[model samples]
Target: MPTAAFTTLGCKVNQYETQKILESFEAQGFEIVPFDSPADVYVVNTCSVTQSAEAKSRQTIRRAARQNPNAIVVMTGCYAQFTLRRGETLAEAHLVVPNPDKLRTVEYVLEHFPHLKAQLEQARQRGETPVRRRSRAVLKIQDGCNIYCSFCSIPYTRPVMRSVPYQDVLEEARAMVADGYREIVLTGVLIGDYGAATGSGGPDLAELCAMLTAIEGLERLRISSIEPTQVTDHLIELTATNPKMCPHFHIPLQSGDSRVLKAMNRPYDQAFYLELIQRIRARIPNCAISTDIMVGFPGEDEAAFQNTCKVVEQVEFCRAHLFRYSPRPDTPAEAMRDQVPEPVKSERIQQLQQVAKAAARRYAARFIGTTERVLVESRSKLSGLMTGTSDHYLQVEFAASPSLAGQLVHVRITDLTPDGVLGELVALQ
Candidate 1:
């Protein structure tokens, strides 16, 4: 059988798409091999989110080339889709399938390599078994981001909002449940804007949640991320009532200062964001609310930085993904005046990170002694311990056999650490 390996970069949507492609390959009698191993084909699912991400994609492609010079090196994803301007050429691949329909990519492989036809036929006759995914399954219900934030290159790379048909999403969810995936994280670039592009308008995210809740045996359903403005009353109410929905929300709060927000082309302000948080907390008291905070955007000064810190102190996010705003080429914010000094950006990022860590520690401390439902992810590489994430998304570590992986178990948070929560397995129930 022809051997194939894949390297996926970027968001959960890209990862989920890679999995589907892998399944298609397996169905066509392709022996899935480790990415480092020599293979007949090497697929690099690229990301162009940041300049660094694009660099990593190139590095991975080079590594694949080194592993097997003769192997078909296929590249796809955001980077491949927008490589024309970047001047990147997939010269390594015998057949370059740039951003092809994922399922069609599989068929293209089979057609190109006619020698695998017999093997594919036999595999098809036997039918492919549902592959079990580790810990969390990222179900890509939607794709593309419509909102073009000034600092973002994602909209340029992955323009247009396209949601998978409602029925197709349901079918994927059911398949994931059957494959023993306890947690399904619905992922997309702009997931909140799901049904706007499609004329169906039949099912918004709230309705999608309702349909997902009906799927039996699915223990947890989580949204990867959503904008504050998109968090509708119906969505909040549904999350409050749905037992399957995880009690965690990661909303991006780029800046607290209204001036910075306007410069960044962000729709909402500090007041709007704080009210949204209040509403969420009112509905679900123990919800673990997290956010993305970008420090050192163009023109930010001491006052603006202080305003962010004040907001952080007041709003008290469970955790914050602190980022130093690096100027991406061709972004609107990249050309803006009063660009923050590299030294200043670095200093502010460190300060914000410390604050974020303090907040996370405090949030995790609150869960101590509480028996929260955790889905076991993997054995820790550091100490050979079992680790999992609580329903509220706290990383909890405990002693357990490898057999515990992928099982939903209740673990009582015993101690809080800066990195993760130390826990004791209370019961499997």
Candidate 2:
């Protein structure tokens, strides 16, 4: 059988799309292989959220080409579309599928190499077995963002807003649960805007989540990064009340400084953000809050950066993705004055990382004596122990039977590791 390797860059939406694309290939009789391994075909679901991301995307494509000189190298996703928009091309990519046409990559592959159809015929003649993948799966229910954040290019790349139809989402949820997936994480560029434009008679994000949690055998549901402003009181209540809801919210806090937030076109300011976090924590005991914090942007000075640090100290996010701001072409911030120096950006990132680390450690320490419900996904590579994520989003590792993988279990937190918490298996749930 023909072999294909895949890799994804950027957001949860991209990761979810890549998984769907991978399944499409597997359906066509291609054997999936690790990205670093040589294969007859390679697909790179690229990212262009930042210059570094695009550079990495290009490097990944080149690496795929090097892995198998004669292999078909495909590039799709944001960077592929962005590159063409700039009238540039990646000579390394044998096939460049547009971001909107990403899921059709397998069709493009079969169209390019008609002989692959014949290869599939032979593979089917031999026989096959379907394999259930990861215990937790990501299901993208919405797409596109209209926020037009000053520092983002996503709006330009993925301007079309549409929600996956109501029946389709629930049907997919049932299918995933039937496939043995214990949890479903909903992802989108603007997930909270799920049912607003769709007049599909579908439920809004909160309602959709409630419906998903009702699926038989589905143990957990998680909502990927949502804008702070879009989070509603009703949604908070649903998240807190639902036993199946994973007590975790990945709300993006791009910047903590009000001035910076305003310049970034973020709807909420420092006070509003603090109040939102406070409300969620107050309502849901020990709920995990993770965020994204951009370190430098045009006109962000020492005071603005200090305010961001103060917010981090206050929120004490269980996890924070720290990144330096990179100006996107045609975005408003690109033309703004007073761009911070690269050295300053680098310096601040180091400082904020230390602060974020200590804050996360403090948060993890709060649950040291408590038992957490963990969905055993896989074994930890570093510790060679069974590992999975807790309901509260803690990465907990413990010793258990490998056969117990994909089941929910209770783990008593013994201590905090550098990455997450080390635990002992208490009971299977």
Candidate 3:
């Protein structure tokens, strides 16, 4: 059988796209292998979210090429799209698929690599079953972002706004559930901006979640990441009340300073962001609020940086993704004055990371001794305990059998780990 390996970088949206692309290849009789292993083909879903991301994407492509010198290396995603848009090419990529047509990457592969097509045809001709392994699925219900945050390249790359039809989304969710996936994370570029704008005759994001929860066998539904402005009150209430909807919110607060937020062209101010989070917590006690924080934006003085630290302390996020501000080509922030020195950015990153870590630990400490429903995902490499995410998005681990990998079980929080909470199995829920 023809072998192929896949790797994904960047956001949940990229992960979802990679899954779909992999499924397409599987249907064509490609044997999936680990990225480290030698394979007939390699696919890297690249990201260009930041300069570092672009560098990592390139490095991944080169590594895939080195993994199998003769293997066909396929690159697709934001980085690939950016390179192609500039009339440049990645030397390591044998076949570069653009982001706009990423879902059809398998087709592009077949068109570019004919020997693999023959291998797939021969495998199918011999009547072999396609390999399929999935426990948690990511369903992208929306795509494209219109909110042009100055430091982000997503708007330039995915300028259009589109929402997947309600019927199509429901069908996919039902199919995934039937396929034995206990969890489905709804992902999109701007997921909260679902419906109306794209002419999809569908309900809004909250209503869509309500519809998705009705799918039998779907034990968990997660909203990957949402903008602060787009997270409506209705959505908060639904998440607070709905058992199917995971009690986790990944709202990106790029910067906590209002001046920095304005510089980034984010709509809401720091006060608005804080108040929104407060409202969410008020409705849902102990709900996990995760966020993305971009540090060292242009013109961010000590006062502005301190303002961000204050917000981090106040919000006490369950998780915080800290990013150093990287200038993207053609963005307004690229030309802004008072660009923070690398030394200053590094220092601020350390400071913010310490604050964020402390806040996360404090938030997690509250749940110790309480039982939470956890979907066992994998065995922890360090602790040898089965680790999975709880209903509130907290990472909880406990001693359990391998057979319970996909089931939802109760875990009583026992102790606090550096990154998450350790727990013991209470009972199956």
Candidate 4:
């Protein structure tokens, strides 16, 4: 049997797609090996989310090539998608299948090693194991993005908003639940904008939440990252009522200044975002509201940057991802004249990041002495510690063994650290 290795980079959507590809390869009797291991084939799943991500993708591809110089090197994902659109030469891969139908790619690999066909057939007939082990299973309910935010490269790399059929989503959810996964994070390029396309008379995110909550044995369902504009009243209401849904909202607030937001083509402004956050807190008390902020956007002046800082301080988010604006090729922001200097952008990112860290510490402090339900994910690599996530997505660490990996237990928050919450595990009940 021909051995193959795969490496993936970037978002949960990419990770989910890579998992599907891996399953397909496994079914074809391809012995899955580590990326560092020499193999007959190596697949590098690329990412173009940021310049760093693209650089990493190229680095991984080169590393894979070095591992097995004679092997067939295949590269796909966002970087390949963007490069192909630009008519750029993809020299790394022997067969550059640019976003080829995933299943077809697997079949192409199988054809080269026909002797493994009988084993592949047997594996397919037997089916995958029911109880698979995973700390967190990403369930991609949607794919692609429609709204072309000026600063984003996603719409170009993953154009259009396409939702997985509701029935298919339910089936996948059920499967994950049956596989002993305690937490299923609903992920996508544009998760909140799910069901907007296709016009299939399917349920919106609120309905999807309700449906998933009804599924028996599923301990938690988390919304990966949602847009501020997509935080509908219905969705907020559903989250308020749904016991299974995590009380953590990560809404992307690219900029606080309306002018900056308009330049970036983001759908919501500070006032609108604040209102949404207020509503969510009003309904779901103790909810950890988080956000994504982009500093030094095109046309962002001192006032605009200060405006973003003010909003961040005012909102006092539980946590925030602060990013310095990096213009992607073919995006509107790249064409704009008033791009901030690198030093200034970096300084502002640091300032905002400090504020976010402070907010996170404050949020974690509130949970000190409170008991929370946490699903133990893994034994900590540090020492005899075990780590897990609380219902509100706060990381909790305590002493545990490998046997408690998949169990949900109540933990009393004893200390608040900069990195995570230190907890004492209560009875396993």
Candidate 5:
């Protein structure tokens, strides 16, 4: 059978889309392989979220070409879309599918390689089992962002606003549950904006979660990320009360300084963000609050950076994704004065990284000796132990058989590892 490999860069939306495209390939009788291995075809779902992301995207494309010199390399996602929009080309990619045509990637593949179509037909005749990956599935409920943050290029790359219909979402959730997926991560460009512009007659995000939780076999539902301003009281209450809703919120706090937030066009301030975290913690015990923090924005001086450290100290996020700001072409932030020097950016990132690490350790320490329900995802390579995620979104490692990969089990947290918590299998709960 012909083999294909897919690698995704950037956010959960891209991850979800890559999964969808992967399934499309399997439907056409393609055997999925690891990205590092040689394959007949390679697909790179690219990201242009930052300069580093774009560089990585290019690097991955080149790696794919080198992995199998004769393989067909396809590039899609934000970076590819940006390149195509600017009338540029990636010489490494055999085909470049724009963001708007991302869903039709498989079609492009079959069209470009007619012999692959014949191979797919032959595999169908043989009725061989198609290769699959992932125990947890990502379901994209919405797409496109209207919030044009000054530092972001996503709004420009994915400008259209639309929501998947409520019926379609429910149907897909049921299908995924039937396929033995215990968890579903709901993803989108601006997920909180669901049901606003498209008039898809779908339920709002909260209502959609409520509906999804009712699926009999659905063990967990995770919201990938949400704008701080878009996290509503209804969603908070629903997550607090719903057993299927994972008590984990990943709300991006790009910067904690009020002036930085304003310049970045974020709707919430440090005060609002702090209060929101307090509310979530108050309502849901052991809830893990994760966030994204961008250091070294255009005007982020010592005072602004200090404010961010203060917020990190206050919130004590369980996990913080820290990165230095990279100017995107044509964005307002790119033209803004007071751009921090590279050395200053490096210094600030180091300081913030220490703050975030300390905060994470402190938060993880609080859960020591507590029992957590962990849905076993896979085994850890570092420690050779069964690994999974707790309802609170903590990475947990315990001893168990491979058979327990998709099962939820009770685990007693004994120690905090560098990445997450180490636990022992208590009982299946």
Candidate 6:
């Protein structure tokens, strides 16, 4: 059988698209292999979220080429669009699929490389359809982002706003549940903008979640990442009260400084963000609130950086994805005055990371001695012990049978680890 390899970068949206693309290739009798292994074809779902991401994307493409010089290297995703915008050509990429047309990458590859199609036709394919591994499956229900955050390039790359039809979403969710996935994470560029951008003409995000919980085999539902402005009371209540909903919220607080927020054209202020968190905690006790924080934005002085540190201490996020701001070409923030030096950005990131880690520890410590529900994923690469994510987003590791990999079980949090907490198996839930 013809072999294929794939890798994805950036966000969950890219991952969902890559999964769909992989499914398409497998349906065409392609034998999927590891990206590092030599294959007849290689697809790199690239990201241009930051300059570093772009560099990594390019490096990944080059690595694919080195793996098999004769292989067809395909590049699709945000960085693909960025490459075209920069008027640059990647010699290693034989097929450069457009970002918006990423889902159709397999078709582009098959059509261009007829020999691979002929090879697949000659060999008998034995794969009994590829099952998405483990328990959690990401379902992309919405596409395109219109928020246009000044520091962000996603809106530029994915300008169209469209929600997957409710029926289609329901069908996919049912199929995922049937495929033995216990948890479904709903992902999108701006997921909270589900109905508004171009109107789904059906259920909004909260209503969609309500509909999804009806799927019999789906043990959990999670909203990957949402903006602070989009968390409505109805959604909060559903997440707090719904038995199937994971009590973890990934709301991106790009910057905690009100001045930096305004400069970045964010709608909410510091007070509004803090108030929102307060309301969330009031409704859902011990809910894990995770976030993405960007450091060293233009004009983010010591006072502004301290303001961000204060919010990190205040919210006590379960996890915070701390990244330094990098100027995307043609973005508003790129031309802004007083761009913090790289040294300052690095220092602030280190400082913020320390504060964020402390806050996360404080958040995780609350669950010590409490029995939390976890969908046992797999063994830890570092600890070699069974590790899985708790309902509240803690990575709980404990001694367990390999047979219990995909089941929802209870783990009694015994003590804290550096990342999360070491736990003991309580009972299967």
After TM-score superposition, the amount by which residue 278's alpha carbon in candidate 1 deviates from its true location, in angstroms, is 1.7
Cα RMSD to native, each candidate? Answer: 4.3, 2.8, 2.9, 4.5, 2.8, 3.3
lDDT of 3 by residue, 117-158 (tens): 888888888988765555678999898998899988778878
Measured against the true structure, the TM-scores of the candidates, in listed sequence, are 0.81, 0.89, 0.88, 0.80, 0.89, 0.86
Q: Considering lDDT, which of the candidate structures 1 and 6 is the better prediction for this target? A: 6
Pairs with steric clashes in candidate 2: none
Per-residue CA lDDT of model 5 for 38-115, tens digit only, reads 899999999988977898999999999998999999999989988988898878899999888898999999998999
The CA lDDT of each predicted structure is: 0.81, 0.89, 0.89, 0.79, 0.89, 0.89
Off by over 4 Å in 4: 1-8, 22-44, 56-76, 80-131, 156-159
Give per-residue CA lDDT, model 1, range 1-429, as digits (tens). Answer: 567888798777788888788877876667777687898888888877666577788888888988888787777777777685566576664555667665467777767877667755666677744333356777887777767799998788788678888888889889888877788899888889877456314799888988888899888999988999999999889889888888888899988888999898888988999999899989988788888888889989989998888788766677787777878879999899999998998898888888778767877888888899999977777767898888888988998887888899989889986587999888995
Tens-digit lDDT track of model 6 for 25-50: 87787877767678999999998888
Worst 10 residues of 1 by lDDT: 127-136
Model 1 CA deviation exceeding 4 Å by range: 1-8, 25-44, 55-76, 80-97, 101-134, 156-159
Candidate 3: RMSD over Cα atoms? 2.9
Which 10-residue window of candidate 4 scores lowest in summed lDDT?
A: 127-136
Q: Model 2, 274-307: lDDT tens per residue?
A: 9999999999977899999998899899999999
Candidate 3 local distance difference test against the native:
0.89
- Quote model 2's TM-score: 0.89
Candidate with better TM-score, 3 vs 4: 3
